[model samples]
Target chain A: MKPITKLTENEKKSALRIFWGQLRKVNRNVPEQDKIKFLKRIPFFELLKKHQLDEVARVVYEREYRDGEYIFEIDQPGAALFIIQSGEISVEIPTPKGEATQLAVISKNAFFGELALLDESPRSASARAIVPTKVLALFRKDLDKLNSTNPDITANIYKSLATIIGNRLKATNELIERKIKAVA
Target chain B: MSGSERSRKTRRIVVYSMTSIFFSILIAGIVYGLQPMILPFIIGAFLAYLFKPLANSFRGPAITKYIRAGALLFFVGSITYWGTTFIKASLPNEREKLQLKVRLQYRLNERYLSLMNLADGGKGNFIYKTLGQEFDELKKRVIDYVKMSDDERKRFLILQKEISDSDHENKKYYEYYLANLKNQKVDIEKLKSLAGSAIVAIEKPAGDDIGNLANIMRALSHWIILPLAFIFILLDKGQIFHFFLRLIPNRYFELAYTVAEKVDDALGKYIRGTMLECLLVGLTLFIGLFISGVELKMAIIIGMVGGLTNAIPFVGTFIACIMGVFYSLIAENVHSFLPFINENNLMIAVLAVVVIAHLLDNAIYQPLVVGSAVNIHPLVVILSVFGGSLMFGFAGMIFAIPTIVIIKVVTETLFAGLKDYRII
Candidate 1:
């Protein structure tokens, strides 16, 4: 084992090569390509680069939900953003008459609970799996951890999350305006 | 349910129980057989756990996985090396200081005993009377031995050296006994028997050769095996977790994963935060004591012991305070830092410092560093510490809270799952 300070350029390069080779061998389970593909599907991750997406993949937890299972309840303390990998999720809010009104039927590649990642707030609406669903959850804790270690990647993730939330707010305002116009 | 389904379920249950029992025994056997190797692996796992968040942070576009792991390993290894070197350099000095303090304590005790004998009208001073004569005879023998010819002196010295070398503590006591000898009645046999028993009690068992061998093994494991395990475990944690998940049946994978995540959430934050809190507290105490002119090495040792005990929740602070006071008293009596600073004043200062440290920890550090990691009540923490101590001693007390939190999370999850399945 050569001391790092004493190593020549060639030796350093060979050491790095071997180190990377071992790492790649150990991490053969989660392919970078698969992680990239998964991240590419979610609009909230659109601004992240391939490498940044790989960082996100390292912290993202993949969860599977059976059909008719509630992904999260309305008014539950939100702690993560969920991206659907497969199957549909119904995003619904409770109406004044004590009934659930369907807001949207979110499908694969889409995401929900994006607001949770940006702030420590309760979920505004409930999300339930309409089918057997596989979702990738990127927790706020993991993001905060990432922020300390890799600020660049965390900044990109926050930017992407903000954009997605901004778009959703704009769409909601438009829907309200149209509803008012129709009522008048 | 169908008849075939019922039979299959029963068989599955039986097999599962048998498998669990077999594996438990197998694991126990392996642990017992490889006890010497296990400490390193446990320490490595703990190190890997502690560094996981930091390691994860470095896994971004700029740094490759290998570089991140290597950097972490290098950092941890350097710290460990520096710490061990520091301890090695300071240990002998600390030991000498402690021995000096012990000798002073013995001298003080002997003086107090002599004073009591004089106050009691020396004739009825039974303690002095009984032990004094034996010590006088012992002193006379020593004087005679010293005055003897070369061959006689050599024979006497050989016999005396064997007894004296048996235990350092008893040798100190013997010195006190000889020094305090006076013209008073005594029982030589009884005094000799008492001193002999004390020597026997203090003597290290001959079996310590095996113990020393184990210690050497542990040291090798700590220095070499632990860091390597930590690096490798940090590198492939996700892969390892996935491999374990794959081993679970598909039907149970989600449940197991959820349970594992809950356990991590319950234990990980608490453990990490508590460790950081302890380090901060320990470092603060060390600095405070050093500033107060406490002996540097003794200050470090006391601060460290206090900080490590801080893991046991409520009572740990009190224990640390007691230790602080005890050491401060000893320091004041032995080597007065200043003429104005008497024993009482030093005690008050020590207590005040410890109290202030505790206040700062509770008000500022605990909220920020530890922060609702474990939601157990204060009362529960106290009870659990006692209960754990009673059941499993010191280690239990340290781990009891986290263990309870894990259990709570598991039970709540199980109840929620049961309700979801409409089985309750």
Candidate 2:
């Protein structure tokens, strides 16, 4: 019994230190590897280097949303990106033809509606959980802290994104053309 | 280079240039032709964005697209109805008030000549009498001038016609034709001068004034188009997403996806959070004020305004507070118009309610609504709101904070590498 109590005390101290370390890590100016791990899982951080990824991770936050919850709506102002960690979600977009269309199904490791974050555009779609969802999110407000000090990394990241978004646009057009042709 | 590589490179270049040009032109055209309408378009876009989540939330395989669409339309229509009715009801009263004010000023000038005398550097009580005498003289002269002009025009036309008719038949016809031709020439010259004047009128800068319901209607029309535009956008999101991805270099998919995801998350949280905050705050304020003994109608109106204004951040609180105070003064108990309420008591009561409402907003409403609305710091919120007001005037004041937040996120991610360095 005496030996068991001693073992428990040591374990408790280790747990306390670990918790304190995590808290300290969150407040640090430099980005953390754990944060980058989440960022790297997102498509936007794919091209970021170790340090750049860390900066993103620093601004990123993790949140859990219940089942049937809204990630966002069509007309709300948008200011962040959402990367699903667990559960499934769906995207609904309104058509000019006065229809709300199901755009896509997003699952774990999936992200939707990044365009709104990049510009002042309204949300193009609404996302809601099909199941309980966990998400890692990054808001736009903290981006300046990094930009003021590191211009090159910021430029590169944007340049990379521009290229990727550019490609997506091209592919979308092709698909649209194909659909039109098929319909015709 | 290999033949396959060369063709692929050419294809890539064409796609890149074409999409780039198309997007630029689309954005430019929107800005140029729809500048005034942009707000409404934005509103429409926001409506669509907000409802999209609800639609999705209700969606299962069984829910039809049309049903979802109907629900979205109904909800939006009701909101629009309420907003429009509020404006419609208020507008007539406001317009009448404005007209009365103008009329009162004119009457005052006529009766109280002393006011003008005071304005002018006139000596003693003599100035009042002098001004009264002058005004009377001016009024008489104006009435005479108008009467004289009408009489002259009437006499000239009659005399000209009589002269033409009294002559021999052939001579009369010839004389009449000549007179008609002379009148035509005068008319044409006048029209030409009028056209020249119109061109100058068009060149003058548009005057700044409080944008009224007409402006709102125009804005609404722009948003009406957005639903139509959004339909196409929604239907093609998959294809559009794919196309955007394909346009970028093959290596950049991950980066694009990350940026896209981040943006989506930010906007989604912001929109939903702000709206939720508005509704909750509006209802809470109404209930709170009513319970505290304020008039039910005024309380509801003030609450709604306060809640909506809270969405704007910073100065929104002050505007809402002032509105609340104004309503307290205007709204009298229906029971007694004869024994008018004391202004001092009303002021004190209003001040107390407004203080409580604001306190609740700052402590509970903000944390409950705004804290969860966006993740930016309070300092950032203040900075963004102030900056937005400076750049966009009132609208800018509302939007600037959110825009700053987005910028901050983007900057943080892009320059995540440089976070440790101190630029200042």
Candidate 3:
């Protein structure tokens, strides 16, 4: 405090500007290698080889969303698959009673909107950023272009997509069976 | 808003404004520096973009990318060389005769138009009087030909003999006289009134001097810049794409990328398809004209024009037909290598050629290449063409479709993105 008082008027103004500038944070640049490693951890891309993962990482676009911002809404045309890079996303659907129901709270390293990669269709549910989040978006068009250029990688992504979807269907079936038994 | 939040927003706005201004200046400077070659650069870039898929499809090692590009360059360069050589050989010799034909065609068109006006509103009586005077002169000439002196008759015979003896196209001196004599068989009993409706007013060939800046730029772009630009783009290993893509900030990256990809896909197919379709149109026109007994030079010019202006809907057909008519009007007596052709039926034949060319374009070329319409409103299409022509002449009109496609894709995507991203 004493040192600041001793400083000249112009110097004090400069110091304050510097302090405010410091408060204005810039996003840190994540290396492409880190993106590839994170992509490898996703079950949806488990079938892809290291080189294929690298290609995907290179093609994916980084997007930032503020807390409570909707990434996409229900019935909106989905053209891309999104993977969480940081923070949280809430995947939600509307109930019959006209109330909003949270289907899942997706955290870092999780993925959503996987159906869009296979075909362009209206999204089944809405995905919104639960907190300030960064995401890596893999657009279907880019993926398709990449697939077209390399046939081997094309099959891998589809294989993984099918497996994950199949697993989800089985899990839902098991849940339904357990509910029926409990009701009986 | 709270003071800190408001101050932070104010700071962000200032930074953003400054950044935008700085970038804009940089871009402007770069554009200004490349202004001279800008046309060529654009031509080249589009060519490269259109052909990228083709280049990618060719199987080769990475090094062969350069080789393939070089081979393409060579192929294009050779074609240009051949084309220029052909032009150089034909133009100098044909210049006078071509000029004369054009002048005669222009005067004929002008006379017809004025006669038409006078016929329509009973206006321009002065033109009617001039026609009356010309009719008298024509009568005198016909009579003079009929009552030729022995010496004049001998001279005409000698000239006719010489023309018959030689098999040169320039033997038109005799053919003109002979065709005129042959076609003067207009039946007096069946003569109709020369009403305004009787005259078919085709659009005139809007002329400009050859030494214009646009023409020079066009030539430079075609011969030099187009190939260089195309090759550079074709050989790029994603660096060029990444350089531009890197500028997109994190917040807008996904939206920008997706928008760009869509625009690229749309523009690429549209341009390439349209160009190929035009090429086919030109080729068909050339073949049709050549078969229809038109002169080689005339056929080539009209075909080229036909193909180029096909971009502007009916304009190509109009120009091709009118030019074909002009050629037919000035043709030699023994014009057709094919026996079915003659001066009397030449105009019909020319019209038939143009019709066939267009029919081919509609039935085959449009479907096979362009795939389907972009579904722009007809009114919008017309206004865009008009706007483009107003700004940059015929080239603008040709470029209008692709420009509209880009705009449409970008606008639609950005609007959707803003809504879906909840940025608005």
Best lDDT among the predictions, by candidate number: 3
Label model 3 with its docking quality class.
incorrect
**In candidate 1, what are the lDDT values of residues B240-312, reduced to their tens digit?**
7766765665344434555666677768888888888888878877876666667787778767877877766
User: Model 2, range A1-184, lDDT digits (tens) per residue?
Assistant: 5554444888888987777568646755442565567667666667777656755665555556666667776755556677887899889877899866887898988777667547646677778787988877655544543465556566765676687789999999999999999999
Which candidate's TM-score is highest? 3
* Model 3 misplaced regions, further than 4 Å: A1-38, A50-54, A65-70, A93-102, A129-132, B1-9, B60-64, B92-228, B236-259, B295-297, B333-338, B342-344, B376-383, B393-398, B408-424
Q: What stretches of model 1 exceed 4 Å from their correct place?
A: A1-31, A63-80, A86-106, A118-134, B1-40, B53-105, B110-177, B182-225, B236-269, B280-294, B313-339, B342-398, B405-424
Candidates 1 and 2, the one with greater DockQ: 1
Residue pairs in clash, model 1: B129-B185
The top-ranked prediction according to DockQ is 1
A1-184, model 1: which lDDT tens digit per residue? 9665688899989998788668655654555558667787776777786656776787776778877777776776566788898999999998899988998999989888887777757789989899999888777766876797768888878887777778879999999999999999
Query: Can you write out model 3's per-residue Cα lDDT over B75-110, one digit (the tens) per residue?
Result: 767876887887776663332443343334333433
Question: Docking quality tier of candidate 2?
Answer: incorrect
Q: What is candidate 3's lDDT per residue for A1-184, written digit by digit as tens? A: 4553488899988997676445322321357767778889988788887666766776776677877777777876677899998999999998889877999999988899999898878799988898999888888987788877777777888888888899999999999999999999
lDDT of each: 0.69, 0.59, 0.72
